[model samples]
Target chain A: MAESRRPLPRPTPETQHFWDGTRERELRLQRCDACSQVYFPPRPFCPACASRKVSVFAASGRGTLYSYVINHRAPPGSGFEPPYSIAVVELDEGPRMMTNIVGVPQTPEALQLDMPVEAVYEDFTDQITLPFFRPLEAS
Target chain B: MRPGSVAIVGAAETTELGRIPDQSQLQLHADAALNTLADAGLTPADVDGVATAGESPTGVAHYLGITPTWVDGTAVGGCSFMLHVRHAAAAINEGFCKTVLITHGESGRSRIGRGGFSRPAASLQGQFEAPFGTMGAPSTFTIPVLRYMKKYGVTEEQLAMVAVVQREWAARNPRASYRDPIDVDDVLSSDMIAYPFRKLMCCLVTDGGGALILTSAERARDFPQRPVYVIGTGESVETPMVSQMEDFTTSRAFRVSGRAAFEEAGIAHGDVDHLMIYDAFAHLPLYGLEDLGFVGRGEAADFVEERNTAEGGKLPLNTNGGGLSYMHSGMYGMYALQESVRQLRGTAPAQVKDARISIAHGVGGMFAASGTIVLSNEAR
Candidate 1:
């Protein structure tokens, strides 16, 4: 409920496309044209090859919970409820991103490693939509 | 090119360790420098080389009223001082300067005259990681630790023992901020700051600083105190942010720096008499032990849990109580170096009997950077 007080990120020119895609509920990833390597956090060139010939593309928005921590203490008045989880999710394209696990109890029992998760967007502002992760339900 | 060509002639911490709300950050640096200068039987004029981190070396040199022929300000993180020692040794060997002085001071607890770091909103960490409500060191450091716990099956109780053992060492040191005995249960029940990490697992926030003086091995014996020969030194950097570490289970910088130092010193693991690993968190020592090849991968936890690194154990670690029980003034590396010097000089409160060789390894910016120094009481 204390969503408004959470720290918000301001996108730079290098990461504008990724942030813009979040507003449309799309997870954007940078793929290297030379090596076909996909990387996260939206870098201009490929981390593997350092090639500037990279393209931003809509990702599958699906990933697995690689690792996480359940924070019991929140900064005073930060609006983050206690027992919330901060996590690193490994995307299907072979890149990882830091996010929060939502739509489930923020506990070790609920947020197991390697659990399937999908991206969910919360529009904190008209220009910014932070991407979070939620457990994927079996079809 | 010899490893023991340079030696540490003087080492001392701030007059007071735990809390000094009145002293500014620079004054703390000056106090430690003056103490070390007195210990070395030298004055500011004798300090021809200077190095520091968190604060500008120029500022330290100017305030101490000394002009240096050589200066290094390598601020990689908390481990900056370790790198400074390595650089100072190289500088001295190259005849850049004869006597090198390295100082570290931070008013972390008091926040008195400490510099602030602000990144542009578009910066890599600012854009990617900081926006996600990641709290400072406590929260960011947990990223890899959680993975390490799951991958290696490290139990919470095992991690708690790190604090318990270090506290046992702390009980002996009079300058230690926390000398009370603590148990695994005490650490487990302490306030959970971040998941998988309790308050006891984190380092104590205190205001203090330490200084070191290094000169040629030829002039080392001329000094008043027992010179701790700097046999080997290595320094390296990995990533600026913990979230970007190459691996979650191990620190690449630790391996690089430790291996280089071991190779330079030509000493085996069994030869080490005392060890000091920068323990900003309990997990760091675990990584340092394994990554430095002291113990096999995945065996460090059991090694520590079995009381190997505790008092009277096969390998006594953190004899000055370490950052966990001693005083951590932001940059904890300087204090680690000071403890190593103390152990080599046969003057540590929790001295290891007949301890000849001490290795001081430090991590800066989580696992982002590392520096390792090998010291010996006698020059071969």
Candidate 2:
């Protein structure tokens, strides 16, 4: 079998570390050695300080929902499904991530603005996994 | 840097807005491109530079049967072509080419019903966001609009004013999709797509093509008719993905580009007699109002609610109905420039009285890129 000819994003040189770290079920963040600004989508330099001296570090993977939308339309591709919760999450590391909001009903009636959520990595393949979020219970 | 004057010497539109069953995507682009050349009294040989985004240009290049000296296929966002137009002007000024042609076409209204090309930035948005029933534009844009309401003390009635005003402009044009008169009550009472934005608040997708011919001031003066000078133009890009945006309430990209355009044109924002802003949604103008320094933060609601953007109001916005009512093939910004050219030419049926100086704005990928072009009657 050709592994069902799945539609998975192939990591490029610009984003290899991000994919590799995700495979091992860890959230790696790129930090600017100059300004110490932690960022996502691994790049060559710091966005804030424009320093080339950047390093990767493990993140706590804890963040809160900044904003979200429920897409009722289906995206292109075989594995795609509709009515998903696409969200903008503000990580504790001061970086905002764009990911899906899960483990809750995808509805305008259910989704609340600025709600608390946490990241959990799901292994989809031996070489790939994704960091998805679930609702955090009230402390 | 100051560039030579550029005029919208030619402009044209396709048959329908939302969907056209009989035509291919390339056919739409070809029809408009060829028609615009005919309108300007030029041929394929006259165009040495071509710029476009949205779809690949292999077919368009083949259909037109003319190779370009410089061709830009940068696909940043819907307004990426607007950024391309600015680059085209720079190319013309440097003598890279004489006549630059800009065009866009899409079968979105037909092929996918509500489809979009594979956007590079959208991957920043996960597929998991869909199963939760994400309503696309309603979820992405309306959320920030809600934050606007909370911060600015703007009422729903104020937001409705944008839709009402555009409807008035759309009604004047025979080709507008939402041309029927819709009152403030109708706008307010329409079903909510996202909490803050209602049905009437969003733009309609139309299957069509739009393009323009831009030339140097001297070359334009030698042509058949008057040449509208591009006094000043500026562009800026922020976080391409919405997730990377620092603040939803403020558009930093708009603010930066607005300043550059104003400074380059040597004109105050208040000096603009006519305005043509991208209206992917009726609420989009509020972003322009604040970004252009037309109103203070959160004051856009009240400013628009007072009907300041209406046809007879101080600012006559989107005379050809805008993307909300006109055409949203891919890059609505190209049409924004075209509509302003019409109004300045006194050809717009909904033309503002004695309209001269105009401002055209384009919002690229997910509100990511912004470009402002100032058009005037005389060469600056």
Candidate 3:
């Protein structure tokens, strides 16, 4: 049996910069020039203030685990093993992003809520590099 | 809209509750719609408005041979039916259309003529969340519960108790898919699908559908069945992504929608005799109970643990076994609404005694949207 390919993010013009940063091994996020509100999952404008004067910059790459679930059932063709951690990490700059927690046991005892984590990049293809997180100490 | 100005004269689910591979998704919608119309002693010619969620209103209307003056295709997820009811009422009050028929059907389990649940690679979820190995509702919807539990001191046993009590109700309902008695241990020991969520904690993936017919309250007396007045209705949306929810512990959409419905009804929380919170997962009711103002924040787990939502309690919730034990087609809002109508009409299988007021609340996506409806046995 052939290994199923995992789904990859298809970036749009608005989100191209964030993906570009990931390829260069940097976590990028957007900040609003009007309200000074930092946001994630990159958008062209500030979600809070609706200001189009948003700027993208390399983020701190540090965050705390906000919430998560240890998924035992992987979607067919997702190329993930069972019992992986699917997590939402709240970044230091104040936005949550969904990412997998790497370099630790995927257990409730190990993945405590509010534990500090930092970003680590994995090059999936020449054009795509995914940003995952690890325990802050491990990173 | 004025309270009791609109009433549900016809409501019915497909004759068969589960596993209907023979029927296409649209056929299931037609089945439920035809059954509902028959219940009211009417036909397609009587309906001038059409509303549906899973399927386009135009398709449902044309398939049923009804020339509708008003059509609504609110595809907000499971709770789309509840919003349809609310919008249809407003449309009726404004004379946009007269008689409205709302339909819902999904071949959730069989996947018979059902659209794929895939997001476009460029879609927000595809770009931001899906690439992170999230399987489906089990992986995503169950994420916030741990945070909720940590903040509220809610134990896993209390969460399991939700499934247990709903099963107790299911035991009384012959139509429920799983009627056997289950305890907290049974739920906790069930196969783990996602961390902190077991198979029993998740809703059933069954194939079923339901429909409702709404008309002016003045003509409600002419119907064969007792009229379940649509006293109040409300709907709201929050975020598309579960990770971006305003707060992880509570659902803003549930709060906004529930409060609007209660205010419109001009009723107190104590007046509610029956309740049906969309139980896509066990944690949903916990959030619904708190967010809907039935219980204080962080109080729902304790409320369920004390059997307050069980039989012979102050409140009767999920009387039709809920989505947990009852048939949960992908879109479960219509079933929740159907159960509310049944309770208000004194026809539910696990009927609450003299249940005068029933509230049916539903959630769409992963707390992305919500719709709430307040029903009364009396027009006033």
Per-residue lDDT of model 2, residues B1-380, tens digit only: 46446666777666455678777777777777887888789998878888877655554666788778888787767666667767888888788888888877777577632344442322533322322233345566554554456566667777777878788788888777678888879987877565556778777766877777888777787666556778778788886556666787777888888888888888877789998888787667988888888888878777776778886678878878777666676567877887887777777878788877988988886678888888876666
Q: Is candidate 2 or candidate 3 better by DockQ?
A: 3
Name the best candidate (by lDDT).
Answer: 3
lDDT of each: 0.90, 0.72, 0.92
Over the stretch B140-174, how does candidate 3's per-residue lDDT look in tens digits?
Answer: 99988889999999988999999999999999999
Across all candidates, the chain A TM-score values are 0.95, 0.84, 0.94
For model 1, name the residue pairs that clash: none
Models, CA RMSD each:
1.6, 4.0, 1.5
Per-residue error (Å), model 2, residue B197? 4.3
Candidate 3 lDDT over residue span A26-135, tens digit each: 99999999999999878899988999999998999999999999999985556898899999999999999999999999999999999999999888777778889999
lDDT of 2: 0.72
Docking class of 1: medium
Instruction: Give the lowest summed-lDDT range of ten residues in model 1 chain B.
Output: B117-126
Could you tell which candidate, 1 or 3, scores higher by DockQ? Answer: 3
Model 3, TM vs. native: 0.98
Give the CA lDDT, 0 to 100, for residue B354 in model 1: 95
As for candidate 2, its interface RMSD to one decimal place is: 5.3
